[model samples]
Target: MYSSRNMCLKWLLLLLIAVAGGAVAAASSAVRRDGGVTYDRRSLIIAGRRKLLFSGSIHYPRSTPDMWTSLIAKAKEGGLNTIDTYVFWNVHEPQPGQYDFSGRADIVRFIKEIQAQGLYTILRIGPFIQAEWTYGGLPFWLREVPGIVFRTDNEPYKFYMQNFTTKIVDLMKSEKLFASQGGPIVLSQIENEYQNVEKAFNEAGARYVLWAAKMAVGLNTGVPWVMCKQDDAPDPVINACNGRSCAETFVGPNSPNKPAIWTENWTHLYDLYGNATRIYKPEYIAYQVALFIAKLNGSFINYYMYHGGTNFGRTTSAFTLTSYYDPAPLDEYGLINEPLWGHLRELHAAVQNCSDTLLYGQQTNYSLGPLQRAYVYSGDERKCAAFLVNADRNNTDIKFQNRTYRLPAESISILPDCNIVSFNTAKVAAKCTERIRVPTMKFDSPMLWQEWREVIPVFDSTTLRSNLLLEQMNTTKDTSDYLWYTAEYEVPADAKAEIKIGSRGHVLRAYINGRLVGSAHGYFRNFSFTLDTTVLFHRGVNTISLLSIMVGMPDSGAYLESRAAGLVNVNVLGNQGSKNLTDKYPWGYQVGLVGERVQIYSMNGSSKVPWSKYTISPNQLTWYKAIFDAPGGSDPVAINLNSMRKGQVWINGQGIGRYWISFPKPDGMPSQTWLHIPRSFLKPRGNMLVLFEEEMGNPLGISIGTVYLKKLCNRYNSYPFLGFSSTRRS
Candidate 1:
């Protein structure tokens, strides 16, 4: 929820004209021209005083660079003076000593875009930011680092984390991006929501937080540093609260020396792939904000995701949806026609009208009735601001200042001058879009289907052979998601045997002697599963190949880095006898899917390999290619992956991440069937679409069309795929 910055927002004109957020303060001890940002017991010191600071999160990597300028502009228009973003370390330093800041990972460019918009910036530099990101935003290669233990007081972990954090701070200093350096950045945050997982690490976690605080403050950013979701964030490092409603629960800072700032007020809540979409009510959000500022004496407020963007590529954690559009005020496509957008814009403006009073006034409270209360901020020159609240489940009459008013249930009313009600949290002019009637899309007929060739991996020298079963992450170092475990074994007689595989997996697919067996996938709670599929084996040398797929890495919990993934154990059990495959290193391992090699997903690369007649065979590694013209409008494009099983997509050689349609949908609203493609990602004609299906899937139902905004990267750059040897029978 945000309103116009500089307070030019004048909505709800019938009630009263809202006051504008003043320009940057001249200069004082609190803030200096040469660049110094300080804070007192009340609020963050910006431009020499505690000004009205309204912020919202818009993670840069979550969206496109082409979309950044437009997204930030919308935040500005919606009354946001500040834009906060987390510097995802995984996006920056993807490898040890190897860093990338190009294209969408260009964070400096993103920050400059915010500066260009004339708004403040809050840089949340978390090497371990767990925003449902892949490996909690830690680079996949961190698990490969020797003597590494994540998030604790481990020396190796701290070394990498601090190194990256300093690199970012130095980068900001070099670019003059901090407010103290005459840049837009006013605050810097280190370590996000550590308290949530702190208890798991025990005293070591406690020590790590202190060290993180000291280390961050030592960076000398000239701005005060903060740690959200840390209760014991140490001296000098301001600890802020993060939750749905900070106004009702957040009392103040842990110490009297700090301001009561809300680092995260979630405007939307996201779920894993199978779960339904959920969000908060706009009116309730407003009421919470009113209570926050009026009752809790709240200072700064930030919406976690003012513009919830997509989890493009393979950036999400295990089982998380590719669509990270959390139903925030701004939809995933940056479309802002939703009622929550307009409603909150007005709400922010109304609260901002009383900013001056709250910042300088002495607070006073009184009981109007049962569960009814009033907070009066009496400031200088008899000027005042007041908030009337009814906390009961049912609306009740409250008398304040000799006037009787009916306060809406669980709502707050704001009076900028302690008189006329300029804004009431319960009374919104907009209608809820839930009850509206509208089809999800204006779909063009399914694109004309064409016959395409397919490729099935032939286990041979192209894959790595080992005498023993290798741990997944260590063997591949997370170079790719798919891994193959193939072994040739003797079977005494023609019989059925259970191929038991204990896989620390998101998915496991098996193939016996070039024939399909079956596949099993893990849910959100458990990514590890044991597969006991029975298959017939002729009395001879039979090849057993098991493919282990990781949806994403473990993001939270203690010692996540040390946790084992992939197929940990393999065996064959039958009435005749039981044979163990893992004990003697009896398998050959392939790091990634054969299609991933030779760039089979690419338009030009697909031609190198001969493709045969199409088959929608289940439990087979397959690739499908097609082309289509770009949709006409700027509306976001949608490609329905309903009929398809689990797989990945690529457009014009760009990987759009993986998809799994087999996961049954609970809510039944299209069931996350469509993968949204940005309009900018498409060309007018001949847009190459490629799919690497892992199982039985029909491309006939696969359609690329346009959907309105209403419903809503890459490793391996340095090293090319080794050698490619193909086995094709025509």
Candidate 2:
């Protein structure tokens, strides 16, 4: 492994390369500053004056429409003036030329709701957004487009990209959603994080960026355009920063005319499956924001997820948890995270109060020792603001303005009046609370089971032999996660043979002559593993059938768009004879599971399914359904999947997400036992709950539950008022 010093040096070299590249992109044109939304090096000028912006991201699809109003209101009350979101292309344009802007995919309505709440918006329209979404928010059908290449300067790719972007802009224009139209959206983004893989595309990547910038400019949306993480972003497109702390390394904007802005300061990493939940302390995150304002003069700061909602349906990419970001200030259910939420709200108000001075004031800096410094902003009429920082690990006192003040370790003190410490990153004065759960089976029922509409490959008598193993994504078009392939092995004499199937898998289950042989799944996305099990082979035409399942597809890397997702190869090893089956086909394949083809996940479509009332033992590749009434009242709801092994869940035809209760925890239990069920997806009666179990698990143990928080204590009330109460957010 490279040492920390080497890593730092590597980053320095990369930075130098980026700066040199930025200079080249700057030659085309300069950002047009004469507009309704302009920027100086220090601030974003809005309404004809420099303004400080506190923004938060709330992906509309992550939450239900019933939850949008409350979520937006919560963000606004948290002292945020702006809401940031990415338009999910896959969700919007499910099929070619078909649009779905209704329901949760409604970007216009989401924006109008932001406008209704008196907040601005930053709409990142990446037709190729890498938001840990399926296909990185790109429409899966685009892969089926003739002569198409995604995210680079391919003509075919550009056409659809421009088409979708123009569609969104036109829709917003029709609704008057741009700032130029006196709407909420003040900024627009095109293409996301292209620079990370630009090197792989070589010169074509560079050219593509230029074309994208020019195309975005041609749109004439009347708001500033942004290209996030693009150091070489073309002229007129403000290149922005995205990381944990912009202050640590942000040099400035790509050009002098553009204000340095942070597009996505991640609140915390999302839950990667199989890993325990991780957290970034409230004070720790606050310090990053405070340091950005104190040292970098960053006027616009947006949290990637101030409130991370659920990753409903099959939208989650790879093995990510259904709970998108559990460490966010707001939980997946949209409730406050207590101390963290409260602390940041306090920080927001403190910073907002000093906005005017920080925007127009003359800046001065002072160093009081190693990592101990002070920044003072002097504005009109002697009004001033200050930021006292202690970046060291130990508490220290510093004398500033001829007065001594104590600063905690790795903390920053924000003084809106320049003389008093109103907010400190190390302080958490909000009342503390702990969550309580009635996560019991409020409603439980014996579910009816059924065999798939079509026979499993092992049972098919008319199976044709094939040598070719098809790639998974290309065959399914991401419409379904399951693919079935059957291959024949001829054993001249009766013998014990080993059937080996190597797969580019999220999951793979193998069956030899109607007998369950073995199944294996990769813990990570696109993991390569083999399912090898020994079986007695009959002399004539023994059938080997394999089922490949994609838990989630790849969402990153330069060539993820073309990554294979199914059985790569298979072989039979026996003393009688050995042969490779992968070379045998003209492989025609089954598109997906019969249940999916029959649309069993939807209410109307499920009635057509043939169900058996007789109870069956827990088995692989099975379907089960139960009808139950919704829990009474409006509190948030969750379902306990502890009884089941692995499968996806759907309620009233709305998919919650896939669940794997078998992945062993330290206590030999599943990592996540209870999963969220949005209240909006629930109805008062006859809620249909469907499960497609891929492994042996008892469905009878499933139950309904409720999760709520109980206030524990308060300690800061007796202290003098340093800032407004952060709990006033509700």
Candidate 3:
């Protein structure tokens, strides 16, 4: 038997040991409260360690929800650690007080998907996202708001801005989406490239930026907030660089305490209507990346677009085509655009391998000669990395630290270790480039198109009268794009008459006595024109009707509200006398085509409507409907609209988009005629394609086709995910 004192002593010792073990376990399991996301002047600290983050922009609304996972996964496989996207205000709240977050607008689902893939997210909540979206991502209804001025220090604008921003923040907080709440979102962005046009707004713009920064900070989301392209961004709000190459030198008026982050590294330029596609070489992009990492000591870099998807509906602006195919790593169809994708993957890996050294090491740069330079990053005694760059057009041999490196023209050599070259921008690995081809298909059954005439309303006594020509936007309030102008004139026997009209409308069609006459449109802006047409008229009252159509609203300008459309003045000149009919005579007005009011786009909806088998020539307003079998398979379908003139298309009652082939070709835009159809929207049979041709072209040539892949080049490139491979360059 042990003594009582000895027993007590043994118990005390055991208790001390248990407490010590508990303390050790607690220390091992403790996690950082900020979800391990922090930043300093050098780099972003993730999981309590400094890291070099490579992010890519993939807008949620541009793609389907079903596509979010695959797109994000592909981005990950391509060596991206983060995904970025813009939150479209117009898409969420198309009408004030009414909100939508379902379908393609489900931004929360998109962020969750990114998180599920173990990736970070950067939410760009730009209420004024000028991503070629209609009205610059601002609700058209905002124009209707009383005493409202956008993107400035206006009280009404700020009130709505705060409301929307608060709603988003509250929703994000409730879902615990911020990094501080153990979610995937590590950063938030407010305002886009406002600095570009800030000078126009002047002092108000400066005040608005400060207010925006303060508002963003007040949201209390435990993640860093950024203001892209805003040079005057206040402290606590990081100012990010956006452009082709946002290297360290490009860091604008940003606070010195924040890490240098490139918000948008443009991989390719956005396509404009009537312009040919702009292609960015993969080799050059790789060189830019290597230079950014080596020369600029870049911490975090995000590609503007990893996947540039379709711009469905009326979302296209700046005269851009419906296809938002921005020649990115992933094509518009979501397939890997190889050589570019693989090459970038290799470059990402090379950078990631030296992430520690790049983030924490002391960087030293040396200029060997003109356009030839070397960068060395020394983390410690044993860990070091270097980059040998030759930016000249000719190949050069660079001697660095007793080693001669053959640098190719405008290329970069990445040495993960200071000793050997892991990858070179000039030495491309073999990879298959995907070329999209539209395959010809023979329909099992011939497509039959039913035609209908859009009845033009005649003037009646009930027609509203206005003395002065009214602006279309103010008069119709965007109710419709079409407007009618009518007047009466007495035509004397054998009298020659001409109608002189001054207008700012997009397209103008004049008709005398319900008969189609000549049509005229301004080359650029609205101008004065005289229409002379021979017509047999009695010595009594004659009817004159003119139709004006607007392509789209002006999205950018000062005092945009003052811009006017439609006939500003009208006069009739005859041998007998001249009449100023500006607002002297009663004018008849109509909002839209008859087919729009009747729902003629749908087969079931238009079953009661009479149809004609005969098709009309291009120029007159007409509706054409065709039924055909769906182009089967997983590949996306597109209708070649090259045969058709300017118009709008509907697929099974869903509006595809507006097409205007009549617009004059710009320098870079090619004559585009293909319109993409989402695979999810297609059915096996009884698929209908309805077109409301405003200005005509042949409808008989319209056909449906699937995009087929063709190998552009056979460049063998090794990816970390695909393992190492040795192959010859194409």
Residue 428, candidate 2: Cα error in Å is 1.3
The digit string of per-residue lDDT tens for model 1 on 1-730 reads 2336312321222112111101111121244545578777778777666866779999988888999999999998888889998888888887788889898889889999999999999999977888888888889777778999898899999998999998999989999999878898988899888888777876667667767876776677778888988866665677888888677556468767577888888887765766665666676677777778877678788988898787877787888877675477777767774566767788778878878888989999988876788999998999899999887767788888888888877778889999889888877665434211222332223343333433333446445777777778778776678777888878778999898888787788888887778888777877778888899998988877777888776677677787777887888889889888887655777788656767876777877777654444432466777777887756667787877878788888876767877776575543366676776677889887888877777776677766554222112223211110221010
lDDT of 3 by residue, 556-631 (tens): 5444445577888777777777788886567777766678777788767678579777444443688887777776
Q: Which numbered prediction scores highest in lDDT against the true structure? A: 2
Model 2 / residue 634 / CA error / Å: 0.6
Q: How close is every model to the real structure, measured as TM-score?
A: 0.89, 0.90, 0.87
lDDT of 2 by residue, 482-519 (tens): 87887666667789988788888878877777777888
User: Residue 724 deviation, candidate 1, in Å?
Assistant: 58
The candidate 2 region of ten consecutive residues with least summed lDDT is 721-730
Residue 284 of model 2: what lDDT? Answer: 69
Rank order (by lDDT, best first): 2, 1, 3
Order of the predicted models by TM-score, top scorer first: 2, 1, 3
Better of 1 and 3 by TM-score: 1
| Cα misplacement distance, residue 460 of candidate 1 (Å) | 4.7
